[model samples]
Target chain A: MIKATNLTKQYDNGFVAVDSLNLQVNKGDIYGFLGPNGAGKTTTIRMLNGLIEPSDGSVTIEEKEVKSENALVSKLIGVLPESHGYYNWMTGREYLKLFAELYGVDKKRIKSRVEEVLEWVGMAGKADILIGQYSRGMRQRIGIAKTIVHEPSIIFLDEPTLGLDPQGQKDIQSIITRLNQEQNVTVFITSHLLKEISEICNRVAIVKQGKLLEEGYLDELIKGYRLVLRNENPTLEDIFFSLTTDEVGGSI
Target chain B: MSSLIKKEIREHVFSRKGVWIFFAISILFSGLTYSFISVKELSLLAQVEVNMTFMKALIGISILVSIILGSTMVSGEREQGTLESLLLTPLSKVKIILSKVVGILVFWLIISVISIPYFYALTYGTNMLLTILSYLYLIGLPLVISFSLLSLAFSTWISSSKNATLLSIVLFLVTAIPMFLSTTMKKSGFAHLVDLLSPVSASMLTLKDWLVNRLGFFFIFMDSLPVLCFLAISIICLFYASKKMDFLGGE
Candidate 1:
């Protein structure tokens, strides 16, 4: 479970990325956070995951307030930022082990967790290969594997499927879905692909210009759609586009 | 912090930038020191020669390799994009910076360990053994570590590895200029002022006084004041760097 109350993030240059926004996410939900470029989606995720401090307000994950400098909080959450990079000289397995150790996983379980995570992300075959030799898709998979190597309670993925082929995207989507459905792990995901988000996420929050526009259950929100689009089965895309067109959602 | 330290150590050992040069210097210095001492028949003269040659080798490698290791460690990681993932770990920024500094210092220490044979080959039966130990532990080790820390601080502040390398080399050269000015060029008019600017220059002059002029260990320790001050400054640089660095960018 996660709750953000009046969260605000202001840059030093007087730019407000996220302004006094409130959000709630239930446990075991695949929550998709959607926004256009410069919509403060990554900033919000950074705040929630404790990578950066909020200018004001607070984020509470399962009741504990998230602090940027809290190492214990980091153990419960795993994050793959939108602009992440990996150690090129390290093999995929070694990289995962480094993170697992840093996360304070049991020393004996490190190898097993690495193997399981590599298998989960479909990187078992190339686990020993240097990351410098990996293809972009392989690197993405390895990055995701590192994120879940410690089996954290929550994983935050920002553009997890970015730059991947259609098949790669499908593979990542399946992993997200499987983790939520089978493992009961809470996922906080952000993507520009409304279709993929709709396919996997049961709940979503849309933002534009750093302010929350809409948030609810996919089924409930669709049923409550005020836009009388001709398509009876309007996807999340229609809602997203119409909502983010102006400074705020005017017609949705 | 321990995990980060281990990772850093591995990176230094596996990296090619500084370690090879370190080995070459160690071997070359040892060979030269051994040969220089083997030809001297006079016991007292051989003793002085042993101390002088060993000190030169240790100090030479300390200057070059420390800068090389310090410059390469952080900037290389940042350029390779590993710092981003490193920051995402539970490791604190201070721990990361300290680990990087420690990793390079370990390289300097390894060089020292490898040079032990050279020191023994030259100082086998000499009274200079205590002086050698004292100088290495007090003077040589601190100088190497201070240079390493100085370069690491530069690496942390600068994003470009080339720039960091250039800056670190400049740091090394600053001390060398004073040495060259006072020794090679034999200019003393401003050499005193120049020596005041460099612990290395003061160190060289003090060593010349000790081995060549027969001054005792007290002078060696007393002359190390400048080196100790630089060590303190190196630590302050790390403190300032920890405050200024942004973990996400390593800027």
Candidate 2:
């Protein structure tokens, strides 16, 4: 279980990226974190992963406070950043093996685990090739493999489908669904791709300008929007615009 | 952390640049030493001086390599957008920093070790074991610390890899300028001040003296202390930087 209470992150330049946000993510739920370009989605994710400190708030994963250096939290969480940078010199197998060690898997199991994850991600054939030689799609596949190598209970994917071909996007989407359903992993994914979220995520939180606009079960949000559209013949996209605009105008 | 450290070593030590740099340093030292040996007009003291000069060259080369490796450590990760990915993992910032330092240090040790056989072949029958060991234990440790710390410090301040590289080079030159001037001017006041203030100059001085004759404990102690301090400072600075890292706001 993930719980965030009044989480706030303020920069030295006085920009508040995440404002007094509160949230909870239970086990086995695929949660989507949605926001505009500069919304605090990434910041909130960073804080949850313990990458950066929150200015005036707190986060607890499985009832444990997210400290500055909590290795245990890292052990239980797998993260796929929107853009992944790896050591170009290493082969895919070698790169995955590195994370496996950090995750403290048994030494004998490292090789098999690496192979399994690589094969699962469909990059087994290219496992021996240097990462520098990989295509963008191939890199993304390997990035996902690295994240799952530890078999974390929770997974955080930051725009995991960005810049991929349609086929690559399909492959990742399927993998994410399997991980959440079969493995029962709690997934907290952030993306600009609302369509993808609408299709896969069970719940979503729409954030704008460091504030939460609305959050709940996806079906509920869509239903609420549909009720408004009954009198006006508006598409889901139109409903989204209206809801966001209403929040903006009222808050301003 | 151990896993990250292992990965760092595998990526860094086995890479093309790592191998090439090692081979290049070996060739450089061997060629300079062999050329000196071929000259028959030099006295025994002059031969020792020549060997000492080559050792100094090795020290400088190692420092350069450390800076090159250290500056690219984090900035390169940022450039590739991997910093975010790594940060997402359960790994803490301190683990990442320590793993990086350890990996780079291991590479430096390997390069230093490879130079040993070449030095032995060149010096051939002189009682150079003591000098070599001293250089390895005393001069080498401090040299690695100084360069690693300097590079880490620079990396923390700059986000751009290109800018980090440029800054590292500039800082290297600035640090070395005093020693260069001191050597060229001999016992002048400016040289004295430079020799006192610059770690590189002090290191060169200690290394040069050690190569020619047995160095006193006081000189070795004084020389080694500053480098150790630099290493500690680097750790502290990295911790502080990790604390200050804000992914939400970009400059």
Interface CA RMSD of each prediction in angstroms? 1.9, 2.3
| Model 2 global lDDT (CA atoms, 0 to 1) | 0.76
Q: Please provide, for model 2 over B140-249, each residue's C-alpha lDDT reduced to its tens digit, 9 standing for 90 to 100.
A: 76666667756765665677666766777787787678755635574678666655656676676676566654578787667656555656666677677655543331
> C-alpha displacement of B141 in model 2, angstroms?
3.0
Write the residue-wise lDDT of candidate 1 on B85-110 in tens digits.
Answer: 66667777788888887777677777
lDDT of 2 at B245: 44
The numbered model that scores best in DockQ is 2
- DockQ of every predicted complex: 0.52, 0.61
**Candidate 2: pairs in clash:** A74-B90, A85-B82
lDDT per residue as tens, model 1, A1-252: 888999999988999999999999989989999988989998999889877789999998878778743676777788887777787888999999989998889999999999999988889999999999998889888988888888888889999999999998999999889888887889999998899999999999999888999999998888777455556777799888867776564522
Query: Residues A101-210, candidate 2, lDDT per residue (tens digit)?
Result: 86777899999999999988899999999999999889988988998898888888999998888888888888899888888989999877777887789988888788
